[model samples]
Target: MQKCGLTEKSPGQYVDTIATDAYVWYEENWQHDEYDHSHQRYQLTYVEEGYQYFHIEKKIYLVPQNHVIWIPTGKEHRTTSEAKTVNLMLVLFKSVSELEFYQNVHVFSAPAVLKEMLRYASKWNKVLTEDTEQQIFLQAIQNSLPHFCKESSGLQIPVPTDSRLIPICSYINANYQYHFDSDVLADKAKMSIRSLQRIFKQETGITLQKYMQLIRILKSIELIDTQQFTLSEIAFKVGYQSLPAFTSSYYAIMKTKPKLKR
Candidate 1:
């Protein structure tokens, strides 16, 4: 396993100097299947090409392209790639006073300026020899952190821990393009419709119907960006029976109308 961040000389030891502890790098085809772990420094990850999923606690967050995911120090989390080739720019640094506001896991849109800065920093993964040059480099990243912290709505789904719901979720992920009837899902879970509904809501914090819609919307985003299908065709392919309903649902979840990239 190739870790990109700087390894501390001593465990659990807080260092005061920001110049020595900070690390930055860019990676391609990055995939990690490690168990949940935490570090002493905060991690800022920007997805430049493909999508990635982060498993934190009981929730799963989907981070798409041109977005950022922030992990605070000592927060246990793990990441998995959603695409075959995922590109990313990552930074690991000590929590400074200016960055204290980002103490929780945050997923947001990355501005162009921050993206460029990260790209520039990734070019030199080693510490600079000159004191003045190192100070200039570190200060540039520090100044841009506040600007990149703007919050935008991102997709996050609650993962149910109940054993019975495991297969149900897997089936939905594999066949979200087909209509999912509540009764069928209830039968699969070996529970009555009402009992299944109550347990699903209690465990995942969302209704079964809403969960299916969210899955469809996520799949629609990928299809809209990759395939040459028309919006109506894409809607039908993602299990939406009516174009208006699909458009309305897309707007509600993505906060924008679905459009193909020219």
Candidate 2:
């Protein structure tokens, strides 16, 4: 087996270039580079322990523990983790059958059976050849993926690509913990309030207020995972002065109230 050596550019370049049908790559306490790249094979990233952030274009998706992020073939994206102690397992497949689920990026639940399968498959760090039991096993896992991916994590937020709206999105992302007013946002975009509303919706397909709410909820999820703050504290930290208002907004997007882990 030819092991991939560390490169100054990107540690994943070696594995990404491998010419194989199925491969498993597991990392513990891994720190990723900021470089953006794409893979030829379809990739399934199982978050074995901590959260893995997937970036595609201007959107960012957070895949937490017991969840898997499916990245289709030829989709350019950047993946990184923020946890000090994180475990991630990557399963890459080539020549896979085209299914609706496999056509786009998704962050879905990883079932218990799939988790066990991934753990067992982690032993085979390199490529698995065809007609062998290893390949057969991997094929079974691939077949079972869609069944386990029925629901998404709903942790993604997209930034607008329009030059006029770019600074506006950046400001919301940076200052999500603060209340945003239409006047402030319009001023930030250097446009009138009416034009700002129209152009922002046309560019992002969501209202500017809705976009800010989504960012706030997304940030709240990250803060909730740390388990250091109470639910009220989290609400305030994420720009909600009233706990009920924060809870309402969170439930509206997440379909559940904000609660801290005991």
lDDT scores in order: 0.76, 0.77
| Runs of candidate 2 exceeding 4 Å displacement | 1-20, 123-133, 151-153, 256-262
- The lowest-lDDT stretch of 10 consecutive residues in candidate 1 is 8-17
Compared with the true structure, what per-residue lDDT tens digits does model 1 show for residues 1-262? 2355444344323343335556666788886644676677888888987778888898877787888888788787878664656788877766455455567787877888877777777666644333555556755776576666766443777789999999889889899989768898999999999998999999998888888988898888677656568999999999989889899998877666777655
Q: How many residue pairs clash in each candidate?
A: 0, 0
The parts of candidate 1 lying over 4 Å away from their true place are: 7-19, 33-35, 98-100, 123-154, 224-231, 242-244
Clashing pairs in 1: none
Model 2 pairs whose backbones collide? none
Q: What lDDT would candidate 1 get against the real structure?
A: 0.76
Residue-wise lDDT of candidate 2 within 101-129, one digit each (tens)? 78888787777898889888877865444
What is candidate 1's TM-score against the reference?
0.78
What's model 2's TM-score?
0.83
